[model samples]
Target chain A: MSAATTMVGRSIRLSRRNLDTAIMAVVLPVLMMALFVYVFGGAISSVQSYVDYVVPGIVVLCTGYGATSTAMPVADDMKKGVVDRFRSMPISGFSVLTGHVVASVARNALATFAVVLVALLMGFRPTASVGAWALAMGLLLVYVLALSWLAAGFGVIARSVESASLLGFFMLFLPYLSSAFVPVATMPPWLRAVSEHQPITPVIETVRALLTDQPVTSGRPALAWSGGLLVVAFTWATWLFRRISSR
Target chain B: MIVETEGLTKRYGTRTVLNGLDLEVAEGSVLALLGPNGAGKTTTIRVLSTLTRPDGGSARVCGFDVVRQAADVRGVISLTGQYAAVDEEQTGRENLVMIARLHRRTRPAARARASELLERFGLVDAADRRVRTYSGGMRRRLDLAMSLVARPRLLFLDEPTTGLDPVSRTTTWDAIGDLVRDGVTIFLTTQYLEEADRLADRIVVLHNGGVVADGTADALKNSVGGTRLDLTFASREEALRARSAVGGLADGPTLGLPSDGSAAHLHRVLDDLLAARIHVLRVATHRPTLDDVFTTLTAVAA
Candidate 1:
């Protein structure tokens, strides 16, 4: 009944009503995983178990793609003038952005689960106990939340819907550039250094270690990065949202 | 006054959109802010609706200061923008229900209100269909319905029927009429002269960031000019000849002369044309329309 809850519910309902968006959000990541694991898996040589190395990468990649879904609804709402409508109403100023971020994070969680399920069906063998799996999922969710907010910031800044939708494509490149399918060392030194420093690499590395029962301490950088990214993106998105709504 | 402003100013970058402007609208009445594009009609609505703050002056809605008490102002007013601000992906019913819920209606109440609005707007059959499937008129009606969920005392409509067909525009007008009868105050902006003429009790003509004319529609129309007899001829030379003989302004093949709207005035014009042997293709008396008022006022301001 509150403004925040109402906005979130409205966003979720809107997402549900758009059948194509739902399909694309859940299917695109799975399709990408299948293509890479089957078609490109044989060609990729750095990983001893390509499925093991690539599945975590795909999960993170899918989360990144989920950011596109987040960006689009924000852009669509802004373009349609619905943002102005919300501003004119006697509701919490932050409700609209809160709704979008919440809804996108929920949708991304489902998509991530679907990707993991497909990975399991593709013979991904995980030796981690339930606690480690929980931690991995938590870390993935924090990353998703952070990226979704970043996408939202981009969406608000974007002048057009095309620009907003395309902004998330930069996230998709993380998988290829990072040690998702291959070790960063195999890549050229410059690319390897760039890949090692980006946020996705550490998260993927952490998730991979968690799934394979490796020492989880290596993943600490992933948590720290995700937390920092969430803070920066959340702040930026809040400021952008206020600017857009007030304007 | 349901809405009041004084010395209100707004600027985007170096260009001033709304110069120091003053406005007042009484409760339970319709006030139309009429202007051409970029005349700051929308900017005024934005300020009054609490969507945008003014650069320099103060505005109040329902007695609440727009800046200091914006939340209170928002609680008393609603705005339907130039575009139908509905979610295309959501069905009409869903859109209405969502807004009702946001207004703090209970779940059942929200559903009931949504159904009521759908029926009222004649959108019942298409209520469950996505808004993208609805026609422009339907979407606009739904947009209006969404704004009405809270039953605010004052409603702001910005170019409410800019892109609608004649029939759709008529329907929208009738809907606005219903709101007026319900004792709800309406502040609407439009570029269409006839829309302001037919709907607004008081019309404010905005030009170059200020009110150029403010009065009843009839008063504004009458202030521009009086009745004139437009005589169309076969050629510009004949029109010029007629202009000299009849003593009026000439434009191409037509000579526009002021008329007293009396039988003798018509008779003398006919007699003069007959004696001059100047062929008159058409002769019609033109009453002052809001279009004339708008053109004259804006021309003077320019």
Candidate 2:
């Protein structure tokens, strides 16, 4: 087996051993989607049925939650000397971080699917065709890639796992500040402007339009943001990995 | 030489950790880099292992320049840092297998290698237990075992037995000895004098970011001081009497006198004690320890 495959397998096994991570990645996102659609669904004014309106947002939210999942394990590995051990070995340098990223993407993708299942059970349905579904999935994956590598960067610089987790907490609330729960137009002008420009807004808006078969003026900007974020975060993460590992 | 460093220097900001250091290690021999804390033992190891970059000078391991040919250097050497560096969440068997697989071994080959290492390190019984449950010694053994997965020609061990118990230290020593017997060149660092004395074919004393002394353990010890015999008496007065009669240094119930550490010297010392009618409780010959050499050399450098 190749170094990347071996490291990914090892990372997955290591991350699976943490019960808190399992709850955070899989259970908490599904629960949040259910609560939002059931308890808070009727209060929203702009959307006719909040279940259909909020499922895409929840999918984006759960996928973003993978930031913490990626960060915590990487930080733990750093503290535990496993990263140092990997550095001294005669293997591909990218394998260690790549392993954590691939595992995080796999795990968050599963959680995103679970949220979709729960949303479907709550009377939410997508009007888009199979190709649109595939595109939506691709967009969610791009978000995962951007966030996971960014979180891995945070983990690399963090002195402890708690610090890395704290660094990732802002990503969870990003969807809240944007169009995840309520329409940006419903907010005041300033808040709406801020919400529309944020990364999550473009992503949620694009995914929402695709699933609902609505016109997507935001798709180009969303693709640009995701692609750009992936590049910047991947470079930042690789730079940090190189600097620290060489020490 | 399997490893050589020429004026190898590393600095952390304004502080110099390794300053114009030079070292050489022959193949298939155990070379111990002996030093106290903050003496740059670990920095030297890191440079040689390609884990850290040198600010100045150059290092080569297994004939590959550590900076320009790092991948080649890494391909031929394995380093076990001061910490065990094993994954605590994984079982010993799993850790070994993970490393073996990373080294590009086949699945079955990795498994076979892991089992062999587990048995050789006497970790077979605890192979399935998570490393978190293993004792420090067990974790260290597993760490050493993991480093040997690819059977690199040279091994770098930084303070391998720093926190182990006596029995565990001995076991680790035996394990290292076994590796050397198999013709693996070992470069280990330690603050323990006895560790260097017992395992090192040649000891390099690193002090103040430079090599203060380097030679065989016996040569370093002899360079510090000669042998001396300590005669213990039943009473202080008797020891003093024997000291004056034998022309030796006296302190309470013990008299210390220089000797060649030969049987004849011992017999003559006993003969002097008998002539003086001093009752000797015990007699011990003291050869200068690595501690003595280290302290003296570092003191002189200071």
Candidate 3:
């Protein structure tokens, strides 16, 4: 609908103007990748090449950062009283959330591209065919979409911007406990169970396998987790938005 | 009636905000909901604007129910909240155009409406500037202008001029006056008695989430006892003597009696005091204001 398009345009403009956050979303992940490749790569001998093994993890981390950034703007809108203005109009709550979610996906695309570019400069290489690369990016897109909606839900529940930024903390920290940095089997039994059972580890493993020409053992589970999260998160976010905005 | 509400109520937890209130507003009239803090003025506006639902009773705007036909109510109304709701990062023009577009205006049409409003509100110079750099008054004006982008039949303004400087307040008043000339039905809430006195054709004094007084400004003022003469004597004994001689309510050293505000009435009172050999220290006439009505009503309700 036209209302959704207008809201999307407005949200993108807001994202563009927020230069500090935009820069942080892109630059932080690239710096993290560099740190992992140069400083931590020598100590980890489980992978044939740490750079090749870690790039997929870094990609997922970058999207997590970008997607969680959606919460700040959503919280800002609610605090600013603009959401009341929109709700009083003929505009539906779906259009407003669509705007933020779409903008989050766009921001993730840019951040993901930047992380991949930096990985190549640091001696990282992917052995994937064109179809495999497309599939990997598609899965990353789905994962970002899911996380962004979940962040938007947090935004609606947050009473202030500071509380909303807590989503970023969780997103940034969850990947570290997953298989993104080290193999799940190398961890203690309890830690290994957590890393293998959580959603992020499977997504990172699937992307890593696809890019490295390895056996794709986690593909089905990755799709299942991402798809299930996308459904629950999208439903929760839109429902919360309507409830909060209306009364 | 363009808007009608009967026994409308809302409660947050155990504290009721709107308590079985009833109201009606004819088309093209300015109605001011006058009340102090915690009087539920904002809650009432929120319900009428379709942003909130009442707990017990029903409300209709433009012949559509506020709860069941909320989308239809939204089509005919706009709300400007106590806080300025403009986007700080977007330019003023962009803010206006975005709202216009949300109302289904074409891009060119939205732009034209935005420009026209910017010119009307004297925001042409800063139209393209980001709202972050705008002064408080400029932002308020832009907020009001955005609500007018769709030209709704009814507008709800909750404390529209609450925090503006004097000049900005007057400018906003002028803008609102212009809207009235265009036959727009306005329902505004204000803690400023002067604002309601200056703008409202019908003033409704709300207390404890219900209407305590509703009438024209002059009518409510009159209800709180009209002009009266205050006679202050040198001592409490002289005031008591004057009260017994002239028959007025005595409090300490002063005696207050209802008057028709005539020179002859003052002369007669002075002569009556003189005949009784009571010396009057000061003579002053007090006229009732909307403040008096508000205080009297709320105090009684409390």
Best by TM-score: 1
Listed in order, the DockQ scores are 0.73, 0.57, 0.72
- In candidate 3, list every pair of residues with a backbone clash: none
State the lDDT of candidate 3 residue by residue for A28-99, as single tens digits. 989999999899988987756999999999999879878988888899889988989998998785687789
Residue-level lDDT of model 2, residues B1-302, one tens digit each, is 99989998898988899989999999999999998899999999988988899999989898899999999998999989888888878899999999999988899999999999999999999999999899989999999998999998999999999999999999999999999999999999999999999999999999878999999998987886588678898889888888688866677898776667789878987887788777889988787666667766887787
Query: Among these predicted structures, which one has the highest DockQ?
Result: 1
* lDDT for position B13 in model 2: 88
Which is superior by TM-score, 1 or 2?
A: 1
Tens digits of lDDT, candidate 1, A61-106: 8887886578888888888889889889888766887888889888
Tell me the lDDT of model 3 at B39.
95
Q: Candidate 3: lDDT of A43?
A: 90
Off by over 4 Å in 1: A45-48, B233-280
lDDT agreement of model 1 with the native: 0.87
| Residues B10-73 of candidate 3: C-alpha lDDT, one tens digit per residue | 9998999999999999999999999989999999999998888788899999999999999999
Chain B TM-score per candidate, please: 0.87, 0.83, 0.84
Q: What is the interface RMSD of candidate 1, in Å?
A: 1.1
What is the DockQ score, from 0 to 1, of model 2? 0.57
